[model samples]
Target: MDNASLKKRDLAVLWHPCSQMKDYERYPMTPIKRGEGVYLEDFDGNRYIDAVSSWWVNLFGHSNPIIANAMKEQVDKLEHVIFAGFTHEPAIDLAEQLVAMTPEGLDRVFYGENGSSAVEIALKMSLHYWQLAGKPEKTQFIALESGYHGETTGALAVSDLGLYKAPYKPLMFDVMTAPSPDCFYREEGESWHDYSLRQFEKMRELVEREHKKVAAIIVEPLVQCASGMRMYHPVYLSELRKLCDEFDVHLIADEIAVGFGRTGTLFACEQADISPDFMCVSKGLTAGFLPLSAMLTRESIFQAFYDDYEKLTAFLHSHSYTGYATGCAVAKATLDIFQSQPVIENNKVLAQHMAQATAHFADHPNIAEVRQTGMILAAEMVQDKKSRTPYNWKERRGMRVYEHALSQGALLRPLGNIVYFMPPYVITPEEIDKLADIAWQGIQLATKD
Candidate 1:
């Protein structure tokens, strides 16, 4: 079929995720035929650099041979099984490896098919643990402002972006929200350490006052990707952990987007010198080879659910595709790739260069801020840089830059007014320069208004 026919067919048959269907008419979908490391090829043979790593999933790069082979081999053996009773070797190996590689104290892993479901498991586990321990009143959860966990009901309840959750206000659960550690546009001369302290102090007060009713406090450690690539210092995490301990609140680190060496560490919590009571990790878990997410918790949390079966106090949550054989095998192989390859170390050099180059836009009048945490970088555009006032959402300024970059052979989709890059770990120093160049040009082209 021709491109027009394909586009028409897509509009008729396919429903894209997190999108308004009407916009499909204006911006027809570009059908990607295949992907290689850091690049995607459309059906028309047009190549676009995958700067966002396909919504922050493709960490080791798209179509990596090792992960592909693992999935292929596993599919031939056992495609899937009833995870409730039967388990596979790939599942066992992946869980063991994840426990080893994850943050300290995260000994057990509960699997899910996506990040949202993984977060759902963490939330449910936290509530159930408290309930079984005779503190059923501790059902409330605290989340940060502008935090983006996932799209599911429980995940949406904690997320603060009103645009996504506003309409569903009736369906959302009660969640005490705290202000984010917004370091970029802080009061003049505010140090990162000091700024982190202020944000942590707010969280501490919230936990202290609400700890009796609160089950856990969730955070997107180091970097909050969905809400405009907001980042804070590791010191904030150190202080928050102490407060959680003092108030006896479980610290749930939502590292789904930033885990697997995104922030210069295997897990983002490593930089903070703190271990979460439970950690939700997914995006880079399988190096983007397959859909897999895991919510890991400490032995203490696991014990709470280890009571008699008659009580039904067990954390009895299950997903149909829980521990899917192919995903598990691919995840295991992906971990192997991390060990044998210097992916994390390579990102260290690229992150440094990215931070340096992005600094050039810091003072640009239309540029509000530049945030760099590990290899994840974001450039915030503003109508008034000195005032840190972003352009209105109605302007579609970010979406324009997104489309413009696509036309320029780069896939630099903007998150609202923030243009960010979460390129795969396999991207090289030279590719980093190209990413920066294309992003800068998108900035220049986008600000003509």
Candidate 2:
């Protein structure tokens, strides 16, 4: 009934994701009773501001009424049906809206249950398309350094992060690495645009040399979320698009974390005015109300597998819960909210507030950089700010900030030494100030060695 009792029961049998189970012995989990607009409350009535949007999924807020009502109504009628032969209204409507909403040429949608599944679908689809076209040797994929796509075997094969992929090396296929256009490594006085352009030269060279065997180049677009919120200029995407076009390679934009107005636009790719061959979207697709994902691609790619079933060219991938009626209903409502409201314009104001609230961190002695992209803001803690030296991973400096934030009734989960804020769209400017103050105090405590 209470937080302590529930957490004790949980630790006895349940294991959490992205966690070391033994750590729970020291820092017990807080069992949440309910969640509302930008706030989560435990059984003891203690509330913590949902600063991370519950792992960057919830768009409008927790337990949003519009999405909730849509799900309820759809479940009462038809919860789910086999997506292979039978179709439902919710799935059809959501697919149509997604096609119309995404970039210009992405005319088809493939359903998946989560972000990682979407990545797997895109990777498989790309390879299969090339093979169907008689290019079986085009099997390799190029991914940016420090990129994190998903943990599935196929998705992990394309991801470059060592922390997640190191242990599973035997299971992963070889993938080519390209230098990321992260602006954090920009030289002194170099603009993000100039540094990003300079970094793209390496990618250009890699693509030029490897395009013959490379099936596709998968990128996180403007910001690499799991890689310490490292960001770069839009020019990188524009240049990458040009290179992919010239080389006859597919470009997969993994927009799982940065989609739905989180990056100052409806989609991050729009900033570069380019349409990728495949675009994977999830997280905000159902507004955190249900699990769903859609991978949108062009009609030409869809036509590749349009042959008779005896030829074996048809793509046979599927999830048991594909095109789930309830999930599709929630996603439709989420898009409806986006269309009916001034979400983008209002987010601009909140983003400005976030920038102003965290600006002073640029002067902190132990903080290396305070970067932002739309509603996402991050402050990187360093052992030596002058040289931009990072704290060793064993030090766990970010855990100190996380602990302090919990004590102050706020959720400020850090990605190693990088503390970030990604609150829901329903959060207010006043709440942003409060969350910023909490993060600043936590940073001070964490950095005080």
TM-scores vs. true structure, each candidate: 0.97, 0.99
Model 1 lDDT tens row, 1-449: 45666787788888898788997766667888889999898877788889898988888878898889998999999999989979899999999999998877889989999999988999988888887788999999999988989999999999999989999999989899998997884778898889989878888888878899999999999998988889999999999899889888899999999998888998899999899998998988888777899889999888877878897866678888998888999889989988898878888998998887677888778997787889899999888877878788788788777887888788887888899988888887787787787788878877887
lDDT of each: 0.87, 0.93
Q: Where does model 1 exceed 4 Å of error?
A: none
Q: What TM-score would candidate 1 get against the native? A: 0.97
Candidate 1: lDDT over CA atoms? 0.87
lDDT of 2 by residue, 1-449 (tens): 99889988998899799999999887778899999999999999999999999989999998999988998898889999999999999999999999998989999999999999999999999999999999998999999998989889988888888888899999988999999999999999999999999999999999899999999999998999998999999999999999999999999999999999999999999999999999999999998998899999999999999998899999999999999889999999999999999999999999999999888988999999999999889999999998998999898999898999999899998999999999999999899999989999999999987
Instruction: Note the residue pairs that clash in candidate 2.
Output: none
Off by over 4 Å in 2: none
Error of 2 at 310 (Å): 2.0
